[model samples]
Target chain A: MIARRIIVLLLLLGALAEAWPAAQTLVLVVRRDSPVTDLDSVTVRKLFLGVPVLINGTPLRPIRNRSEPHLDEIFLQQIVAMSQPSYDRQILNGVNRQGWLAPSEAASVTRVAAELNANPNAVSFMWERDVAHNPNLRVLRVLWSD
Target chain B: MVRLTHSLWVRMMSVVLIILAALAPLLYLGVSRIVEDGYQERFINSVRAYSRLVADQLEALDAAEFERRAGAVLDGVVLSGQVVFAQIVDGERKIHSSITPALGAASPREDYTFGQSPDQVYYISHQVRRPDHAVVLRLGFDEIPTSERIRATQRHVLLAIGGFVAVSIGLALWLSAVIARPMVLLQESAKRVASGDVHVQLQSHSSIREVAELNLHLERMRQELVGTNEQLTREIAEREASEHKRLTLERRLLHRERIVALGTLAGGVAHEINNIITPILLYAQMALDELPASSDLRADLQRVVESAHRARNLVWRILTFSRQSDTQAPSTVFALRAPVEDALALLRAIVPTNIEVVFRCEAEGVQLTGDPNFVQQVVFNLCTNAHQAMRRDGGRITVTLAAEEDPGEPQLRPGRYGVLEVSDTGEGIDPAALPHIFEPFFTTREVGEGTGLGLSVVHGIVESMGGLITVRSASKLGTTFRVYLPVAVALSNAAGAA
Candidate 1:
């Protein structure tokens, strides 16, 4: 009986982890000094899925952030509109079919912010709060909400 | 059970089998552990090294194109056939190969060593660093083949142990036969020796030191036994020859003794008959003298006188059979000491060196009215019997002659006599046998030792000479025979005493 309670408690914790991201929103982020601004959800998704995108004829670099537990899943659901497996399949399919290089990845919000500052057209997903106090970073668009 | 215990082959084989039974299983277990351990160690080392090589390759990959070729790299890992599962994980993202890990087998758990998981998979992980992030590469190597190898090696070990046991038992059998063969041969030889074949040498060949030494001792014993048996056989043969001679002599002496006894009995009857005849003859003659010169009564008295005279002649003839005339020589007045000395001289020459003769003649002037041979014969018989009595231990034979007076016994009158006493410090006669000693054919000596007639003849001679003989003996002490004879000088005294 104790084991069943433990398992149910773990299931409830997992549900809360998935449900807690709903109050937060993920925005496409870049360096404040870069020319990138106001990118649409289509351009954002294309940039994260290993498709090369251009703004003012400048090549864009997409950075994947893994700072939060369900942040990537929220981003892939709202903007990319795909499950985790399907999104991974689509990105690997582009690398195999079109011979495109995979996008760069970062594990922490600080490393994501650092990559955007270093690259003039680098793009990434982060919580609104991460760029809220950073003067060097800016949000091009809302990547996801809930 | 008896047969099995007695058999050498069974005994040796059982010992070998027991040793093997104890050792073989231990040998199998130890060897199997070593073999399985060898396969397991090699399996774990190689799998871990292979997984490390894969992670290193990923670290060197082109980071800009890693995601596009990551699936191909992981697919290549699965194609190696040892990796039943392959995946690259970076935080919440996991990129896997096309292979579905064991095709619905039980889920693979991370295994730290060989045989840790029931899924027959060895799980290992290596971290590959990319320019942007690090991915952890994990691989599950198939464990079934290594397990199969271990099992096969263990089977081989078991078979080898079995073979060793069999070879050991075979060697024991051969060795036991080598030892038992010679012993069995020796047993047969011993049986032959027991059955009186002393000539059968105790021989058995063996290389074993103790057994060879035993054979040597047995052969020596057999040789000694043979020599002893031959010596015993020779002694028995010599004894048999002496015995044959003794029995023949005994038979002859027995016949002679019977005749002597018959003569002595007849002589006693004749003496009584002669006394009656003499009275009849004298009365008949006196009656004739008182009758008339021509009377008819004189003829009848003449016939009685003639018949009495015939009867007297017959008595004299019967007296001759009493062994006194066996000498067949006429009697003469001879110095009895001379012949007595001569017989003693002869006895001294013939007797063995063991006996000593001591002679003393006190009656020097005494004369005996008989053939000198009678005195010689009597002395020879007495001395010979004394010599035989002392033959084994070699004692003294004493013979003495003296003028003595006869004791007033029933058979002996009080008179002067020449007494010859023969005594010996030898094996004495039994007191029970003394009364019968003077009877003919009665003897205490063994067969062929004497005719048993010596004392009987001596008795007859002394009686005829107006003397008597007597014997006194004690068991193991000594024996004495005193013969009293009336000499010429004692004739008047003997006649008056009678």
Candidate 2:
């Protein structure tokens, strides 16, 4: 009886292991504004939170990604350095002012940038690969290595 | 209702055996394949290492000399216990061998023969090279060691498989015993239940939970079956009693209907006879008035007068229908209060003195279309039945009459239905018996005390006159009998219009 139970348990565990999903990575992309090549954790967080800041003293707003799996706290700690709660609090504090917008994906960042350039007040984030220049939009400088 | 195609034991045994059978081939092939693969892996690794060694060694020699020296080196290695023989061949199929005697005997001589030989031996090959070109070198081994290792592995695998199969068989036997025994018991219990022994009980004690659960189900089924049997028996007995009462009630109702028909027939005959007698009496009286006192016609006149008297005697038969409380004839329209009072008066005489009878005749100007005497009989019967129900002591009977209207059904009309409710503060009638009460001769009273015809007569008269009667009673609440009759024909007709 015990043996039979063990066999059944093994089969059930096997089935469970087979159902688990593969692990994935979350990446951050930035464009150059100064020779300052890669991003620091603090500046990435501040820009994503739409804290009005200067890059060579030009006021800028950063964009965010809206895709799932939504960037969790772990992703923030390792990459963006700001928790989702802190991000939401910052957004709520500046709701009426021009704030950062999360494009649907990295590809839409160019469109958002073009739209933002036309409006002067609007700004958004997109994937680095999707940010080839249309005449209207330019990459703002941020901090990062490779 | 869901039937199993396979019993637990059979299914378990088949699965165990099939698993064992499958494992036998799998274990044999797997162990042998693993052993062979291990040996082959070692052989290939050794061949690679040995080829590198031979190539390094042969680098200083000319190509032809290299083949010859390589063959000698290979022969030296083969002279060791594990190796059989070795050969060196140029790219052409001509072999230079240290074992020239063995090669002379081998058919289809070639420069390099590798893999398993036709004699069922395992061999390994490598390319020996000079700077310009390469030569192939082969080493042959007897393969006895690999075979022996494989046989040993086979033996271990067989032992392991044998051990597992033995354990599985023992387990299967034990599991089948655990599962099959309880199932067999349950099957037996089911058979017994089918054969009309629902009282049998199943005791479940098994390591196998499913079997234990089955035994519990069997036990529950038995309990349910026993309960259903008891309920069925009770229902059957009640039905039989009801049937008996219904038959008696039917007999009484038929008798009452017959009596009423007889009364109507008598009334018709009496009317015809009375009509015939009226003219005869008129003629006789006229003749008596006109006849002279001195004439012999006086004696004849006296005879005529006597005949008229006899005819008058015959008219009394019509008075039978005029009985105050007879259970025959259709009732006529009358003031409802009088008949209700008259009925209570008669019941007062018959009921025990301890029982109090109260009458509230609040309904006035109320009339009904049935015979007053028959209505009185109905009221009297209902009161007496209620009184008898309260035979223990100090019971109160409340009789109430009121003028009310039908709720709807314009054809039945709305106005002036006289409600006569007789309520008794007594032990209530059983609800089981309530529907049967109106059926003739259906009575809770013992035989001879009641013919059970009272409610049937009540129902018949009430229905015949286009009225309604209802009763309500329960174990907790006392009994109430309500009779509703139309007060006047005109009022009913007018209400129909309204």
Leading candidate by TM-score: 1
Model 1 misplaced regions, further than 4 Å: A1-146, B99-107, B191-200, B229-242, B256-498
Whole-model lDDT values for every prediction: 0.76, 0.62
* Over 4 Å off, model 2: A1-146, B1-16, B26-34, B37-253, B264-335, B338-357, B361-398, B402-484, B493-498
Candidate 1 chain A — worst ten consecutive residues by lDDT sum?
A: A76-85
Pairs that collide, model 1: none
| Residue lDDT tens for model 2, B144-191 | 676677678778888887898899899999977887887787788788
lDDT tens readout by residue for model 1, B1-498: 998788877888888899899999988999888887777766765675577567767867898888878888889888988888888877778788876544323333445557877878777655465777667677778899999988888888878888888888888889989888778888889899999997998778899987889889998999999989999999898899778767755854574476567776767877888878888999999999999998999999999999998877556544543754433577677776898899999999999998999999886767777777767867888898888888889989899988766654444566667788899897788767765676665788789766566766666667667776677787777888888887775564555577
TM-score of each: 0.42, 0.33
In candidate 1, chain A reaches a TM of 0.79
Put down candidate 1 lDDT per residue, A27-113, tens digits, no spaces.
Answer: 777888889866654556678778889889988998888887677645544445444545677789999999876788899888888
